[model samples]
Structure formats: structure tokens, C-alpha cells
Target: MSCSEDPTCQELLDHIYELVDADEDAIDERSRALLAAHAAVCPSCRDAVDAERHVRELLRRCCGESVHAPAALRVRVVSMTTRVRRTE
Candidate 1:
């Protein structure tokens, strides 16, 4: 599906992160095109991209490395995974 067809915010956010983090020259043509297309029209997602970039820069300046995900998020992910697995 085209990027426009991807209705989920998480997909757009993931694409934005990939665009910011991946080497442009190393990315495949299709992926690059998809990111470009998505960023062109999605202002909210673009703001998210900008925010992520700013955070990364701040982390680099202050901590010299990216911060780890919060413990709460990790715990939530583990709990969700266990719940899903038990239902299977």
C-alpha cells in the first residue's frame, strides 16, 4: 500500500524515524520515495520527526548517547506480550 493508505500513526511515526535515522543514500529508492511522500503532507507526523531529531541532538549533547526507553514502557510491553501469548 502507498504511504497515504497507511492510516496508523505508528506506521507513520516508524517511517519518520527510519527517515531520520537511516542513511539516505543507503535506503532503497522505494522507501525513500515513500518517506518523502509521507513527510510532504503530514504536518503532525513531521512535527514528531522534528521532535525526535531534537531529542536525539539533545541527548548527544548532554549524555553522549541515546537515552534508553522508560522502564514503564518495557513493563507494559512485556505484560502485553504475555497476555497475547496466553490467548493463543
Candidate 2:
């Protein structure tokens, strides 16, 4: 989190969210590689990058993949499930 007065430091902070998200649509591999290379030489950037990844990892572990709906809710939705045909 010590951004250490580098011009590129702000660049890293700006794109940190897109970088950590790991979505290609959000950030291309080349841009990510450039940022990573910058972080490699800069201790400050490296620490910030690592911390962001760590926080996201912790959230994934704590929340898990998916939650099951309540049994009653599931049953009610199933009962109400229906399809309507459209007339042209």
C-alpha cells in the first residue's frame, strides 16, 4: 500500500481492480504482464498487489461458490413454474 512516489505507482493503483479480477475482458494479458513487471522491481507495488490478491482469496474462501435456497422457497418456486406460449 506504500505507493512510494512513482508516477507508475498511480497507474498500478488505478488498474488494481481490473488486474486482480482476472477477467481478460477487463484487462489484457499484455497490460497485466507490464504491470506485473513493474511490480516486480517495485517493492511497494508488489506488496499492494499481493495484498489485493490475498483479500480476494480470503473472500472466496469465506463465501464459497454458491448457497442453497431454502427448501420451502424452492418448493414454492417449483410449484409456480410455468411456461406461456406467445401468439403471433
The model with the greatest TM-score is 2
lDDT by residue (tens digit), candidate 2, 1-88: 2334433878887787677776689877877777777888998777677766655554467666444445475335333331111121
Best by lDDT: 2
Q: Cα lDDT for residue 37, model 1?
A: 69
Candidate 2 similarity to native, TM-score: 0.60
Kindly list the per-residue Cα lDDT of model 1 for residues 1-88, writing each as its tens digit. 3446443456656565466667666566577566666766787666566655665565567666756546475346445554654588
Candidate 1: list runs displaced more than 4 Å.
Answer: 1-8, 23-27, 65-88
Evaluate model 2: give its lDDT: 0.63
Q: What stretches of model 2 exceed 4 Å from their correct place?
A: 1-7, 66-88
TM-scores of all candidate predictions against the true structure? 0.53, 0.60
Which residue pairs does candidate 1 place in steric collision? none
Please give the RMSD to the true structure for each candidate, in Å: 9.8, 17.6
